[model samples]
Target: MNPPLFDLTYCPIVPALEVIGGKWKPLVVYHIYLGAQRFGSLLRCIPTISKTMLTQQLRELERDGLLHREVFAEVPSRVEYTLTQTGLSLLPVLKAIGAWGRQLKEQQAVPELVA
Candidate 1:
């Protein structure tokens, strides 16, 4: 029998998914891409996501080296997030996935009936 084409032990998709696979990570990344750096801005961009969940997701992304969290010394202690090079590299993949989603939505749309 031929060897399997993919090595299950070290599948590339597994690592990628480990880094960005979650209900909120992709949306977080998408909003960050659109210049939602501050906490309030990110929260506004994805209002359906709970504040706690958003914090957890951002911390995970930062831990995974996909984002950089900056802290400013001020009266209120401002914080912001920016994508790291690793995170930026995934932009094209995200864009392609978005395009595919739009295409699928278009394909599934019901045409209007004319009189």
Candidate 2:
């Protein structure tokens, strides 16, 4: 018998990681958690990201059905990005991760390390 073309039975988390697995994906999603924001705002919030890198991450997230981008044909070409329903579903996950990180920090040998 032939083996399955793709082996996803190992774990379900594999698929979630495929979408928001990138280093910046989760951060980008977290930024959008507040509300719709402009491209400039996203860049400002994530100062470490370059224009090119941010654009690439945004496109990837959009392609993954986690974000929605709207472009306006104004003088400056306004663009806004907002999280989709699928993306909103990650709120609880993000919150949980944040709590876990805090716990790890508090329990670490050097609690101040988290600061």
Candidate 3:
């Protein structure tokens, strides 16, 4: 019998998914690409996500180098999140996928007319 193809060390995609392949991760990435945003802004943009889930997802993205977190020390601390170079590199791919989805939706909307 052949051994399994994916040992823990063999594939990075498996681990990458752990960081950014959830229902909310892609949305977060897409929004952050538009501009740097604070946590409150992210919560507003992704209204369906619970605060706990959003915080967990952001921390995961930051740990994976897909996002950068900046903290400003002041009377009350300020923080912002922005995409890292690696994350920004994914923008074109996301845009292309979104365009394709829109085209597919348009195609599905018109009923076929019999001649």
Alpha-carbon TM-score of each model against the true structure: 0.84, 0.83, 0.78
Clashing pairs in 1: none
Q: Alpha-carbon error at 80 in model 3, in Å? A: 0.4
Candidate 1 lDDT tens digits, 2-106 = 547676655668888889998899999988877639989998889999999999999999999989999999988999899988889989999888899999899
Candidate 2 lDDT over 1-115, as tens digits, reads 6546587766678888888887798899999888888989999999999999998999999999999999999998899999999999988998998899898988785645534
Q: After superposition, how far is residue 7 of candidate 1 from its true place, in Å?
A: 6.7
Quote the lDDT for 41 in model 1. 90
lDDT of 1 at 16: 89
Model 1 misplaced stretches (Cα beyond 4 Å): 1-7, 110-115
- The TM-score measured for candidate 2 stands at 0.83
Error at 75, model 2, angstroms: 1.5
Could you tell me which residue pairs clash in candidate 3?
A: none
Highest TM-score model number:
1
RMSD, one per candidate, in order? 3.8, 5.2, 3.8
